[model samples]
Target: MASDLSPASRRRMQLALLLTPVSLFFAVFFLGPLAIMIATSFLAPGLYGGVEWVFYPHNYGRILGFADPAFEDFDPVYISIFLRSLKIAAFTVIATLLVCYPAAFCIARLSERSKNFCLFLITLPFFASLIVRLFIWVLILRQTGIVNEMLLATGVIDRPLELIYTDGAIVLGMVYIFIPFMFMPVYASVEKLDWTLVRASLDLGAGPIRTFLRIILPLTSPGIAGGAIIVFIPALGNFVVPAVLGGAKVMMLGNLIEQQFLSARNWPFGSALAMMVMSVMLVMLFVYVIATGRRGADVTN
Candidate 1:
């Protein structure tokens, strides 16, 4: 049948066959749930849990302030959660970058076998359950956990200090999980780095700091930006880490959204919060694309 058809016709058929399953998968799995969530965002919450068919714009209005007087007043706590989540995510990105950037450089300079071994070590966490990995930190950070126990044994402190359920703990956990995500991109950039330019800058009477700023940093920036974006996006919406590390004392947007859906039984409100998170992600992606395009143009020029 393919032999009888024109080349263009056969190509079109092949493309159709290749795209059909992907299209169906996205439609059924991705777009399907997205459409349902968007619709649910606009619907009213029922007296008994679940959604009411009536269209209600207050779902969003609740977040932005100006919620319907009959239901509830707009609370600024949601806004605070949004800001806190953003801060934590940003910190996670910065911390992950700091840890991965220099490590990438070191790994890039290693022998092939050493590089592979280092990569295996970096990716070892992924083999285990995420919850299990997080619990290890919980044990290490808790009052009677490893750190405090070691300190107490050495008489470093009179009592165990609070290590877990704080913003720092959350950021630490995020950095641990996201190390691989940040490392791979940075390593790719570092591996491809034009080291000749670095040597030239150093030879031209430039200081190490100046050479890094003018040559090395700019060369490796794409990987840094990419790593930051990937790390930030998931860190922003991460609930599990915050739940296990932050506890009730520290609430992030992810935890807030979870509470609305599970504890409060307000799906519409939860969907609204989710939409807000998605909006922030889209905005960041747009900014990243624009920045990347401009950088590309500058490089070409």
Candidate 2:
């Protein structure tokens, strides 16, 4: 009496129902702003701050070192900033991975109560405002800051080191802030790990390092990749950390975009810069997806 739908039809109906809210949410929130931003990138900047409805590519050209208004000389300043941002972002990903991997393993190996406490401590910093946390680093890194004071007391140096407003400071801040992001995904993967595989490898002829390189790393790679993407995407476009710790000396793509919009009143150029960042992020995510997919295929085979 109640046999109106096949299994496939029922599954399709359930999926559609489940996806309706998420689809609508993305359409309104994510896609809506993204479409607006992409459209704005091609438009002209208004006389002052806003955008005008006219197509222009000069904004992008300016960023790429063309569209110079004086002497027709090639200006590599913006290009340098973009590349510097990429380098810093890559460094942050590597540093965060190095720091988080061991910490994640320790957390994974802990008792449930200890694991929760460790996780809580790791994430407790998030409760504070990011700006506040960055400012604390600023205090710690400034020439006359705690680090310099301690060194001076120990007679380690005659003068304070130039820590703030430097590339190193920016990288340090980025690594510290993004470590939690990197740790969480790796921890999730480690929590699901089959320890029996690890034991079997060790019971056989495999050393710890060899077993980890061949077995453990491959199994947990998806989480590592996911965490790296999470940390890197944000670090690539980070503004506040650089702006605060860098003293505006170190600049990233986000800082450049923020400058155009806020200082230069160049909305079109800012939009273009934002679009470029999004493009890079998309490319990285695409590569990650393909690699992960290939790994999954290999596993199945």
Candidate 3:
């Protein structure tokens, strides 16, 4: 009976079968949750802790500064947290790039075996539990931690340095966790780089700095941008790193969202805060798409 059909019909049936599982998985896991969240974002918060079915745009108004006068007053802290999260995420990208870019070039120039070993070492941190790794940093940064103990023995100062629970500490933790994320992309770009162009630039009387800026930088920019996007997006919404390293003194957008949901019990407001994060991610994706499209067009020309 099946053999009676044309090849095109059979092919279409196969394609549909292949797509069915993926489509169902995405619809069930991704789209389902996203639809629920979007719906909840517009709904009012219940008196206790859950959501109310009624539409309430005030959830967003609370973030944008137009909350219902009777329920709650507007606060700028949400905006501040959003901005601070952006700043920290930007710093994390820069730091991760700085740490990975040079190392990528170094690895790219190494023997295949050595390069593989180094890559393995770079990824070895992932083998450990993230919480355990973060706790190691906490132990090293705390007042009675190793640094302080060593400094005290050397008599560097009477008091331990304030290292943990700061913005810098948060950035440091993010950089540590995101190094592998940034490195692999940059390494791929560097590994594929045309060294002959660099040599040609030098032979054409361009200085080292000029040759690098003109030849090497543009060629590897795609990887850098890729790494930056991956690093920045997750870093923006990272709560665990900040919670561990930043403490209560330093709160980011992720922490704010966590508090609204878990502590404050404002489900609508929490959903609103999550929507803000989703909005930022969408904007970043849009920018990346535009930049990628332009780069492709330039190459074609």
All candidates' lDDT scores?
Answer: 0.92, 0.89, 0.92
Candidate 1: deviation at residue 9, Å? 5.8
Which candidate would rank higher by TM-score, 1 or 2? 1
Candidate 1 residue lDDT tens string, 1-301: 5499999999999999999999999999999999999999999999888999999999888886668879677677777788889999999999999999998999999999999999999988867788988999999999999999999999999889999999999999999989999999999999999999999999999999999999999999988989989999999989999999998899988888899888999999999999998998899899889998999999899
- Candidate 3 — what's its lDDT? 0.92
Q: How close is candidate 2 to the true structure, as a TM-score?
A: 0.86
Per-residue lDDT of 190-235 in model 3, one digit per residue for the tens? 9999999999999999999999899999999999999999999999
lDDT of 2 at 206: 100
Cα RMSDs, all models: 2.1, 4.5, 2.2
Candidate 3, 71: how far from true, in Å? 4.4
lDDT of 2: 0.89
How displaced is residue 42 in candidate 3, in Å?
1.2
Ranked candidates (TM-score, high to low): 1, 3, 2
Clashing pairs in 1: none
Model 3 residue 47 CA deviation in Å: 1.6
For model 3, the stretches where C-alpha displacement exceeds 4 angstroms are 1-22, 69-72
